[model samples]
Target: MEGKRLYVGNLTYSVNEAQLRELFSKYGDVVSAKVIEQKGFGFVEMGTSEEAQAAMDALNQTVFEGRTLRIDEARPMQPRREFDRGGYGGGAGRRY
Candidate 1:
């Protein structure tokens, strides 16, 4: 929808955003589709809640390219943590 995206998982490694968009566009207008190269998962943004709902209804368990896609409402990203914040050499609780 306007402020939300769908989390699509179990996708083929070689599949890209365009392929995702093309597949989902059948349900409605897809605002954007991005496959995170490192994580092997991706997100799809739709124009409206209706479109998102439609996509979910039809594709939640659909098999594509030898994998069944798991689609769900995307959650907000967790806040970032400093990589070395509480480890051996950093930050507030240093051992004596």
Candidate 2:
């Protein structure tokens, strides 16, 4: 709701929380930085909207680990889904 979190993608897997915070701290207070290993992307939450905006403005084109940081306002998380309940593929009760 605060538009404080940013969607950061195309990151090197080695980038960690402290480095991310340090990198973006120039813009403002970085509340949190999470680099998800599984998803190969991460999120950065700032202390305020202005901080978020500054990060987005300054960091979007900056390269890190040989890749440019893609920073944007974080989207609302989608609802989680259960595994393979029923779909086009076969299920336990279905026949091929």
lDDT of 1 by residue, 1-96 (tens): 445489999888899889999999998899999998867689999888889988988999989989999999888999976667677647557777
Can you write out model 2's per-residue Cα lDDT over 1-96, one digit (the tens) per residue? Answer: 369999999888888878888988999988899889866579999999988998889889789988888887899999976766576543756667
lDDT of each: 0.87, 0.85
TM-score of each: 0.79, 0.80
Q: Highest TM-score: which candidate? A: 2
**Any runs in candidate 2 off by more than 4 Å, and if so which?**
83-86, 89-96
Looking at candidate 2, what is the lDDT of residue 29? 87
Please identify model 1 stretches exceeding 4 Å from their true place: 1-3, 82-96
For residue 38, model 2's alpha carbon misses the true position, in angstroms, by 4.2
Candidate 2 at 74: error in angstroms?
A: 0.7
